[model samples]
Target: MRAIKDEHRAARHRRRRLSLAVGIPVAMAAAAGLTYGTAFGVFGEDAQPRASAATAAGAAAGAASAADDVADGMADDVADGFASVNALGQNGTYGGRDGKTVTVKTLADLEKYATAADPYVIVVAATITMDPKGKEIKVASDKTIVGSGTSGQIVGGGFFLGQGVHNVILRNLTIRDSYAGTWNDKEHDFDAVQMDGAHHVWIDHNDLRHMADGLIDSRKDTTYLTVSWNKLSDNNKTFGIGWTENTTADITIHHNWLRETEQRNPSTDNVAHAHLYNNYLQDVAGTDITSSYGNYSRGNTKMVLENSYFEGLNNPVTKDSSAAVVQRGNVFVGTSGRNESGGTAFDPKSFYAYTLDKAADVPAKVKAGTGPRAATGVTAEAASSTLTVAKDGSGRYRTVQAAVDAVPANNSSRVVVSIAPGTYRETVKIPANKPHVTLQGTGGSRKDTVIVYDNAAGTPKPDGSGTYGTSGSATVAAEADDFQARNLTLSNDFDEKANQNLAGHQAVALRTAADKAFLDGVIVEGDQDTLLLDTAAKDKLGRAYIRDSYVVGNTDFIFGRATAVVDRSVITLKKRWDGTSQGYVTAPSTPADRKGFLITNTTVTGDVSARSFYLGRNWHAGGDATLDPQTTVRDSALSGAIRTTPWSDMGGFPWKDDRFAEYKNTGAGSGTASGDRPQLTDAQARNQEIADWLGNWNPTALNPA
Candidate 1:
């Protein structure tokens, strides 16, 4: 239905439908001489050849009513484009497990349809080979093997039989890696599928391209599942592991498609309960660990990876590295997580002369910072002690919304406004009674400083109906309430080649809506609506506190439905952060007692490390995207470039317990954990519920090591 393949505009609409079906029979013979020239004088006196036959039958019925109004305006422009296109097919169709109807095309006829008391399903469309020495796909327990895609592939090396498998599904199909190992790691054993401790399942789309262990392996309970769209590219050691702790729950993943990819295994394997969305990812930082660990977890766990996307990698995300955890966790990243900053942070001596000789210094100031520490040292002989700011200064405000419209709304006094570095375009908001507004950035090394802009959604506006998704578009919009900012950086530069499903270019580089906001060491890039933190419908208690922040963009770039707290933040990505990242990750415009978007000790990079990403999902919409599941994340750090059933479903319903969880995280995509991580014992993580949504927050003031 999304046919974007135009061969000369569909051959000029088939030669205008062969000139309107041969000009509607020669325009109905010139409409019978225009219906005998308007009925030729009512047939009076021989009526001149009967008035040319009534003007050729009234011009053939007015040329057939102007060709039926040009095919009824192309059938109402295809019924208004399928009524705003959203047929929303989101998978899932073969109910009846063992009522029987199998047709497996390979993998040993799907091992004669394994059965843990009758598990069944094998819907396919093509490619389904697999048999690297036979005996693998041995799934049992309630089963499902869906693939119904035209080009649905599933080449080779897929095996899942870790004993007594339970509810299952192997979806979509496209599991490559026909066994070509030998990186000397002892043949690498070849893999494109494997799920030993399988349980409730629901893999979707499926497309583990160039695999070598792209998707598989979940021990123990195996909990709820729901993988989303699929596509994993290239390969040289892919991943998505889990063992020991064994616990996989409400998993979700959206859109799909990934490139390059690396880190097949950094430390302990992982790919715990997830929910990743959007889709489309390029380069992916030329593989490798790419630093920024992928959606990590261990022991207790609950995951959520928002609208996805992450171009060139290099630590697009990170958290508990060197995997090793017992229990306790909860993870969340909404407003559609993003990535792609490279403005400067991979510090390779200025990127080896900016890539050897391109002289990468696109600088008027590539974020520098060493001039604000003297709002009081200006008296000693008027020395103002190293105070410098004036390329147009009052602490420089060339427009970040005129320093948030010169904050001072419903103030009780607390105006830090310092912004100095540069790149300050516009589009900022902080309304909600500007309580104690703060936006430090007079340079304290947030890599110098910046604040770009690039309005998205086609960037037209003025009622021209362009940028800002919900008809609003953005480029820095706040909603106030103890708002605070730090170090500094916020971009949008929207220009996806000119646009490519960024849902119509709705760009944004920060659009918060108040609560007790406080973004430190900030830096947000853009692709699609990057960084929106909307209180959408407001109050999940509403309060943010993104520490050591950093965000990039693609789609859903940091979504809304507030209640923030992305500590040690750095949730990056390159592309594939689908406006829905597909699977799902914080669509919670919130309601159910309000609670959504709460990334903890965050760090989730993406450059495709085996299993492409997805962390959060099932976010109802204002008035219910299925609220709460209380978005959460604790002591985070997940690598392995995720996407193995994270969590999705904004309205398809099926997410129980309703409160994504994760805890005691480790690295390399930490996979196992129980009771939804976050084992909270130390006085329930500092007076509970992450300090009541960051208001009187105190988690060691987020100075976590």
Candidate 2:
């Protein structure tokens, strides 16, 4: 019997490898262009492909038995992953399965049933768009929000699981298009789904995207949460975890397709046990958004990533200096930047039993199996014309700059340059002549596509023509009107530590100096003067809308002269290159008559020490006091890193003379109005709203209604 078992195991391995070799090309081809029907036929109905014939008759019989084992390994409706781990005396995440079933077609009906005390299975039966836009229906414990076949569509709003809520499930629904006019929506906390300190929840087989804020926000120590077989796309901040300092959250993320998103490809922060496997993260370049990173392990998180497929991501798998990440059996195609793993992560099998599909099969398997399954048949939208960029010869252009060069100098319509997942170490400049051009990332995740360079303000030109000034040191400079970048990273890895002797340390990751410019789901990083949001000229009116993106740096990081609104985004304040804790967040140099910068509905935080940083100091361009340098920080969360006196003087200019004020701000950094800390009154805040600054130009009109 032992001999027979050994023969069967060997036979199964050989057959699987053979099937992979023969079927992978077909799968890849199908993923590229085929419709849902054709893609589904390539794999048949089986979750795992059938094995080839064995050498002998006895071995053939054993191989047949092993095939049965493969079928049994696939997860079923009865909870799997971390949701299956019994905790708090509960068996698993059943989610009102045995409770009374109810059907709802309107917001009132859905809200009524969702907040009820009794357990109920709620079925959404129609396309219901929330009236108040971005409204979140508070859901109680022991509930299920499932779509009625393929008819259920929840638009412009979503559900909220509050603290201690448990035993809930959100499945088989299409929740999308909640985008308000402001990309950096600082006023609305809209999300497809959000849980605060919730547990025993499962989010599976749903399509979520284009929300005003995040697609999914699992914050405040949410544990016993399992996200599986879902499609998250067309947005910034796909999925986030852990807002609490305690590392108590346990999560399982698997078999999901995260595409066209910017960052937080499930950023697991301070998680005790984070088990991710068999997920497909594709960053489709040449779209409106690019991804920054995927599977980020932050704040002492212990993460285990396995058998996943990552395409065209900037940083596919990354961890903070204090985090532990263990990766295995993952396939990275066209990926670039940091694919790091360190420390021994916990064994996922000890907590729950789950099977992983082969990494090579993940893309096909996930695309075919995930998302809402219609009762009739699966369907997909047709592809649009796009210029492809891939370094591996799979795309039309070999380099990103080449694709940009191919675009018509003065194109009338939008020209999308889709970049495949890979590291592109070059500076990209979008000339002013090229308008309505989008630099998109076509990868499984945004982190799969990277556009990076290493040039500091002091770096000498190759032609020996002096230094590349702060304005010229940008990795990606967009000087065209209506320019957009999605789902990618623009990084200036200038090695500030290595070039400490250099006089000028400013390194610009991204500089946008055009009107109606937009950046979605992108990562712009450097050491000093990272994101420079300037106008076409000092007198030109340049309005840049940056949402669902990340800006990382220290001294005068987010400084510029443009009318910029950073909504629903994160401003990460890192220490100086020498590892010093002191720094400033912004150094606005706006013209006296125009608005400098509006950091609203955003979060200001990082790994820096408390009371070490200032909110901002006015920047008078060329010592010109005529510039008002106005900056309003409102309705945002500020970390303790900000000093008590968040404003300061600069270049012989008193910050009090400039326009710097805050309103309704929270966290340790926020304080009452004083001489140094200016606060906006309710009457004053009304004048400083997003609408007041963006007068006559509605940013929301750019997106689909």
Candidate 3:
């Protein structure tokens, strides 16, 4: 039997005892009411050994001195932070598939399909540069215009959704430098993408910038629309919804990165109900978002702001007396902004069945899924930017694996491998010799370029190992040093629903066992063990710089011994389809010396019920491993899926001995320190900075100019 420890060990037992004596009954009854199933161990007895009398008394004294009185507004803060809003509107069925396939390359070919009556999948083969500046192409109904490869652009022009235009899907295209004549010497006309009296439209994974007028304007009774994963930047007027009409406009703007723009990002005019969630707004000269300027004579507008991040902006939300704004789960950093409406605003809950999120955790959620990516080469010139992978043989290679195999061994300079907008179902790996390699996707965002595999930890491999271990089931594995990836999705679609009871169902989406790596605008999805940052070199170990990314999973999703810094990222815990008990988030097995996981300025979202998931636990593999797990989560937003007991024991390792701490965390899941969570002091938090953890390696220097 393992011997019981002292100091913090006794405190852990005390809290466990208190929780069992108090919180179990309530949680069990709540669980039953929620029909979440059993095996949650809410009332399980302590299986480990007990402490001595002296140790217990010392632990009690420590708890008394460390824990302060609970402040007021705790319940209100939880309510404000844990609310859920619909970003995709009432139903997930925004654009159902009922279209015929048709590929188009030039402007004439595109125009032919745009005016066609039947529903068509118009795939753009190359960049269509318009000689006539600001010429707008009118798109007809029932059209899906998707960029086929890296060369898809509408330079000096834009798209126009005229009257009666509906059910149009525009994705993975660039609309830039659109100058539709000049007015008052200010260059007026030309919206990057304009919609007039259109409905049921989906605009996703598109880059719209440098327009004379608004980047996008949906007005004149446009309803039932979803705009996601688009980057709007370097423009005067960003966007405006329901600008002209007093009619009810139902619009959802989520996962959009609005940067370096002026006002109207966007200004909501006569919108009936607008849901703005998980969006990143930065460096705006004017108003960020507004439900104000309302047609007060028409009716009151309702805007729900949830899980949004605002930085370097002023006057975030300005509401009219006739409009109502419910501000929840939003973060304002390094800027002066009004979160709540100054004038009369309607209740968001009254308009829809939704919950709120904590204002503090919004930054993490917003940056995780926002903006256009992998367009760095398209926007600027780079020597390393070359190579393309297209499924229809439009580019150099068709499969991502073939592109990796083509990389010369022991390459010195960085090589950018551009992937087209398509789903490649294959496992990919970068050998150790291939360094300074960048795998990029020309999809505007992660939703466009998808690389997937169906391998779980329980799945058998041809190798001697009976099953693919947790590390072996990854869809994309980068084993080389100085590896980088951006604007793409790596997913492991193992059927966890069918094999719920099977052991080792851990399906890893991305396994970065590299000495150094950087990930930006990336999406990694799986059910369990989604992201594995394994320690690579013995001297350097694994050091990763992950920013502006999204990771989704359930049990031990972000597990590894790597010293990783995850900044401005979104970590989402998806609820199991079978409705079983949700599992842990992080399982770090860091050694005694190294820094394990430092998740800062990130958002941790989930679909599970309140207080259902543990933040992290010390992973022991199989036996009592001497793994001193070190992790710190600060300045981030967490969903209600995290429980009050944020830290818990894993196997025989006591969580009290680990160096897991959080500071300045704002969200529903950020409970008081009296519970399982331990608050870090100012000095202790200073030791957890990126510079402090990474000795000489600077992540900011890695950014390509």
Candidate 4:
């Protein structure tokens, strides 16, 4: 044993003996319903009186303090180090505080809310056994999963925080018993908590032990994390951080108890800043569990170890030659093998503020402080409701329409129906009663979440009543006021070539027939009549604002009578399903006294032949001569596919009879002001701006232009 010589060793042991003597009586009294203050008085004249049982019962269950004073400290503490840095416009890891709170006792309810689109504070109320052993529940961003006192337990399972997920907290739970009776678990990759490429996470005050592989596995460059006040024991590979070759992970591990662990307490590999302080590591010499190493710094990791107590068998502090380790103020008793510390590491104080406990008091403090505490009033209250839709049955609903249907009718506040990243082959509709419903996609990109159908205008209905008309053949129809869709794709996959035997090929992808509708960062794709922007009635005022989105189609794709504005968007003109390149971009049929369609600051391009596509055509609905159709394409980049004479007549309605014009448009397709291609004057173009088309409804306020 290469134990460090210290003159104060006897004094430290005496203090530990006194603490244990005093703590035993207090614990026995508390468990027996006796007076806690009376027993805690054994701490002599300097000790403060313990709190009453009623008051202590309301403290947070994860407080990393002694049982006598667990009520008033570290229960609601924010994370330190890189996790405290402000990123993505969010300051620190405040999980689910902005959303509603819910309690779940079953695995189904836990998985439903944990993988939801909206933020939630989920309280696990009971010991939920995993149906399939070692099933890892995938947790989404902006979530808080905490235990209700010490009753919450997850057996034979764990949680997975995937890539790009952020702002999550896991506290006050016991996740264990995933060990499949194998010391070297090669079959199962079961871990108590695992994260890959996730950031701004806090894992605190939990009891993690007997896992198949690692108690906590932070892999693939997971950063900005703090694992504090946890008790990790009874297994090989207690904790393993960093699997990536890149040294980008930043983590803080403090105030934890590593008892009877074989190795990796914890092994820090390829980490940017690994700060370990105020922890206790103990290993028995004759037990089956023997520590291979205590705190390991491997790869290009930079670690700072301070104020810790190590009572171990072998290799307490070790580092690779390529790694840096700065150790200070640590007491090593009865240790052997390499106790090496060299190279310069970063100062943690530069990133965040933290207090350190003395090394002599670490073993005593960590034993009493680590792991879950008693009950505390840290549970949040419910706010707005959020429903989740996932194709994998992990969320509350498997389909978007089911989540939408679950929303209460005439709801006063907003209800977000969050769609997980997957292809949903169905139609979804938001009725007029659901006004503040927002369909949000939880994905990295808009292309990840897809809602699609294959309905055509001439396709016969299943009821045999009649064929679905142009308006009825929509994949997603929003008939509610104040409706919004973001970060998703809506497509009508109607094959015109395959359906040649059918009559009409007008397949619509999306339709909005209400006021104050907004679409942002979305993809709408189809062939003909792809997007129908219409009103509930011919005389009603229906306005739609689409920004930073994509509209793809071939023939007369965007046609309606509503006052609509497509701003800062992309219009992709595609070939017909029969491999031809002849189609019209828009067929506007505006009312006589309404603003028709404004395509401003947009890019119109596609993979079609030059001069094969027309900018628009006049469409008088049902050949109604009283309707004055209008379309204005201005401040946009037109492609070579656009015809020089962009306007054309439809259904015996002359193009000149309607309002079809362009202003300040660039690109090869744009032409000079001729009688065939009307051009708006500088003064007239101002009246046809996006702001004028949207009226007092400021869609830009919700989603910036």
lDDT per residue as tens, model 3, 1-705: 111111121112212111112111333333322332212111111101111232233234423422321111100001111112233222222121233445576888888887788755576667787657777889887666666544577788778888767767676678888754432125557787788887767777678888778789887777666677678877767787775647467777766788777677777777877778777777734543322211111235677766777777766666766777777667677666454553343454454444334545545654553333333211221122354566754444567876676565787766667788999999999989888777777664466789999888888787756888778888999999888887777899999778767687888999999777877667788878889988775345788877767777788888888888877666777777577647888998777667788887666765567778888888865554666776788776666667787877888788877778888776667766653678776655655666555556654443331
Candidate 1 residue spans exceeding 4 A from truth = 1-390, 393-417, 420-450, 455-498, 501-517, 520-529, 532-563, 566-654, 657-705
84-190 in candidate 4: lDDT tens per residue?
77765546775664456678999999999999999877889899988799999999998888887888899998999999999898988999999999998889999
Which tens-of-lDDT digit does each residue in 1-705 have in candidate 1?
A: 100111121112211111111111223222321221111111111111111222233234434543453232210001111011111231222222323445555545666765435534454445667655323565665555555443445675665745545445555456675645533234455566666554445454455655444444444444344443345556544445455554433344334444454543111234343333343333443344232333343334433333444445444333343322221121222212322111111121221111111112211111111111111110110111111222242221234554454343475545554556666565666577766655555543554556666666655666765445642556656676656666666677767665664567656777777566667656666655477676635443566666655665534566766766676455665554343332222344445665566666555554433445456654455435435445555555555544444444455654443555555444555466433232334333332334446534542232211
lDDT head-to-head 1 vs 4, winner? 4
lDDT comparing candidate 2 with the true structure = 0.76
TM for every model, in the order presented, reads 0.19, 0.47, 0.46, 0.49
Best-to-worst ranking by TM-score: 4, 2, 3, 1
Off by over 4 Å in 4: 1-385, 703-705
Q: Largest lDDT belongs to which candidate?
A: 4
Native-to-model Cα distance after best TM-score fit, residue 252 in candidate 2, in Å? 48
For all candidates in order, the CA lDDT equals: 0.45, 0.76, 0.65, 0.78
Runs in model 2 deviating more than 4 A are 1-385, 701-705
lDDT of prediction 3: 0.65
Candidate 1 vs candidate 2: the TM-score winner is 2
Question: Which one wins by lDDT: 1 or 3?
Answer: 3
lDDT of 2 by residue, 526-604 (tens): 8899999999998799998776567778899999999988775667778776778888889999887787788876667
In model 1, state the lDDT of residue 426.
58
